[model samples]
Target: MYSICRRIIFLETVAGVPGMVAAMTRHLHSLRRMRRDYGWIHTLLEEAENERMHLLTALHLKRPGPFFRACVILGQGIFVNFFILSYLISPRFCHRFVGYLEEEAVITYTKCLNQIDRGYLPMWAKMDAPDIARTYWQLKPDAKMRDVILAIRADEAHHRLVNHTLASINPEQKNPYKPGE
Candidate 1:
């Protein structure tokens, strides 16, 4: 369970980075082109924020050790650059990658929930959801850690679907810098 928790925390930290890089890159592209992003900036940034909240909630569950935190920093740094380059090269491919990432997140969280339910992972008797999580997610007063996990999984599923759909549509066709063209 400890390892699983660490994995989720690490995953969440890395997960948050791609959306931010894509959002920032898109914002720069939009600004350079003197055109609106048509709402993708907001959606991607919101996804980043949601992923960040998941990281924070996991932190509340267990403060990661120094080694773990270092790995997270390194992982995020590397992943951010890779994702930004990928997005610049091909937004459709980048979105597809994010969709895959979100699908994995949903699966991971579901596994965690199952572990908790099966008593393989011992949770607090009355663990309350993190205040940040509750506020960010607008969760009810009775929300617990399990509830938070479920909500995060649901959000990831939604992101997965959205990114998959966006990848299929390829809305950034209007951008002049179509790589490989």
Candidate 2:
């Protein structure tokens, strides 16, 4: 249980990066070019926020040690710079990369859910969703960890779809999905 939570916490930290970098890049480009970003910024910002929520939710389950924290700081530093440079070079490639990562997130969360259901993660199988998870996902007050995992998986699927869709279109094109969609 701790292992899975730790992995998820770390992954979410990294996963939140692209959206922020992409959004900021687009915003700056728009301002420089004297045009709007169509509707991508809102969605990208939302994606970043959602991933932050996921990280917060996982942290509620398990706090990392100092060594793990150091690793996160270093990893985030490297990933943020990599994403900034990558997005500047090719936004489409960055979005596609994020889509691929989201696919892995879905798979990891599914595996965690399966482990819980199979009685391997007994602690999580019996635990209730954290209040933050319940509020963010709008889950039942009595929702369990399984319920939270399901919500996260659904979110990951949505992000995968959105990123792939974004990758297929031109950066200046109007975003097909509306803000908060």
Candidate 3:
């Protein structure tokens, strides 16, 4: 169970780092094409990508020991929760060019959230099996990691709500280019 969680965390960290970089790159490209003055937004996007890359590298270097695995899971939970909150509280922070590229930005955000919901979270839940949960409970009695894990789960659920809302608002639209289409 620990090894499974570690592998999932590693994959998720790697996948997420590149995904964030790509999203930021696309957003910047769109902004540049629009001749927008988005210096601050660009800086923020770069910072986000850098942070994700740093975390990914850290996870990559660390062996799948109990402590390292726990930290990776806890950190991922925090990161995902932070991302969801940031999006909900200020979507413009990430989607500043949405006015000029509404369809593309929305499609990208929806696809990203779908990946988290349909892929990452399910894998996370499965990795967190009974024995793993027991080990986690016994090893980390302070419950900080568990709390963060639950919060991440809730954040993922909230993402689903957001996705459903967006889909309802734009029912006719289709993301035909999405993977596994």
lDDT per residue as tens, model 2, 79-156 = 999999999999999999999999999999999989998899999888999999999999999999899999999999
How far off is residue 171 in model 2, in Å? 1.1
lDDT, residue 85, model 3: 55
**Which runs of model 3 end up more than 4 angstroms from their true locations?**
35-62, 65-142, 158-181
C-alpha RMSD for every candidate: 5.3, 0.7, 14.3
Tens-digit per-residue lDDT, 51-151, candidate 3: 34333432432346678667767776776666555554554453332222333333433443455456644543333323333342243434333333443
- Candidate 1 is scored at a TM of 0.89
What local lDDT score does residue 29 receive in model 2, on the 0 to 100 scale?
93
Tens-digit lDDT track of model 1 for 1-181 = 6787788888888888877988899899989999887767777787788888888888887888889878878887888888888889998898898999899888898888887788776663257888988887789988888888888899899889877876887565433222211
TM-scores, all candidates, are: 0.89, 0.98, 0.32
Residue 36 Cα positional deviation in candidate 2, in Å, after optimal superposition? 0.8
> Which runs of model 1 end up more than 4 angstroms from their true locations?
124-126, 173-181
Model 2 ranges off by over 4 Å: none
